[model samples]
Target: MFDLLIQYEWMRNALYAGVIIGFISPLVGVYLVVRRLSLIADALAHVTLSGVAAGLLMQKEVAWFQGVNPLYTGMFFSLAGSMFVEKVRSLYRSYQELAIPILLSGGIGLGVVLISAADGFNVDIAGYLFGSILAVDEGELTLIAGIGILVVLFFLFFYKEMFALSFDEEHAVLTGISRKIINLLFMLVVALVIAASIRVVGILLVSALMTIPVAASLQFTNSFRQTLIWSVVFSQLAVFSGLFAAYYLDWASGGTIVLVSVAILLLILAVKRIVRIFRRNPVS
Candidate 1:
């Protein structure tokens, strides 16, 4: 399975993109999960889908002029959705979660309309919805790397502010940390990672990459730093294992990656339960 991956350019690109997306998703996702923004990732993914659909729709008329990349369209839509979420959250003030259903429905609705109108031929709409490991190429791999590096750099610079905002938004504001600015920044980062990852993880399963590791890591670690470390470790495990599985079985990379993460999460939960039982009464 491993040898087969090295022989093909598409496989190589898929693996590289998988690792990059693996790191990028949970890196920002950990904070989102901490801040109770878990569903935001899912909502943003649907928005990315809408973007792809919209982009593909444009391809019908301008197929001669513009060289369109679905990933770019997905990024544009995701970014717009991010901004929309931020604005709506601010507008509601008292009901932030309300932003989720509003944007989620809007994205899917637009995507459905676009897909139906275009007869679903503008792009491989399924790829945007479920991911396509085999579809990755050198150009897309480069874009993923660039976006990943930017996400890492952003996190490095604003670690403290993000920490404050995630742990306590009111406290962040009290400390003059500009919660609004940091939140918007966080949303943009989320958009960037989601768009970059859509090829490998797809819109439907990408949120799993963002949330699963964090969910598992919280079981064993109480410290935020430790949680981040474990989340990355689990993410890498899921990505590499799933990549290999997809290569060998011709399965969907996005589905495999998500399943791998879910399996690991379940394993961690089971072990934790067993450990608790053992600690209760260890037989001599």
Candidate 2:
């Protein structure tokens, strides 16, 4: 534990970012799952792949503009892709799901092109594909922390309106809150979180971090606030344990983290079932 962090700079960075991600992800994630927008989060994550690939391909140019850094391009393209998703959602309001497939497919297609062009397809792209607990750097860690703080601030400042919108869009609009603005803001925050998490969890398994905790919380919590708090607890356990396991076993961090979350969720469900059974057969 301490040995790994002491020996590897990357390990330290990954753990730091993972903690921030663990906290913020499930925070906004509860709302997404409640609103049935989990798929949208999944879509935005996939779209970020294009940004990462583009960053790698334009490493030279991006470095020239940003003074020799690849992450700038990655973050830039990610934020742009996120904004694009919002724009697409507005244009295809009647077919909201269409925006996901359109953006997801386009992103992968572009990513493949850029990756092949850069001869980076066969490289150690696992960090971008499945994530690595050893790939995180100081810059990426800072980005995740900054974004995490901003996300919490957004939720804190707009708690009332966000809560209303999450519960019922119609009621929120009826109450004079601009549902459009709130919804767009929610999506934007989701996009930012997903983008910041790409390096830590990758695109494929990012949605798991955003949903598994919510799934677990829903089984035991009826109130929205309770649900959010419990989800954060579950998320923290998943991310921290996964980071520890991935570091020791040298496995894919993204997959490991998500698997850990799922395991916890399953454990919670099992406990629920056993408790119910015991209650029914209390004579023993």
TM-score winner: 1
Candidates' TM-scores?
Answer: 0.96, 0.91
Please report, as a residue range, the 10-residue window in candidate 1 with the lowest summed lDDT. 61-70
Off by over 4 Å in 1: 1-6, 64-66
TM-score of structure candidate 2: 0.91
Worst 10 contiguous positions by lDDT, candidate 2: 60-69
For model 1, residues 157-196, the per-residue Cα lDDT tens digits are 9999999888888888998998877788889999999999
Residue 264 lDDT (model 1): 92
The CA root-mean-square deviation of candidate 2, after full C-alpha superposition on the true structure, stands at 2.2
Candidate 1: global Cα-lDDT? 0.87
| Most lDDT-accurate candidate | 1
RMSD of each: 1.5, 2.2
How displaced is residue 13 in candidate 1, in Å? Answer: 1.0
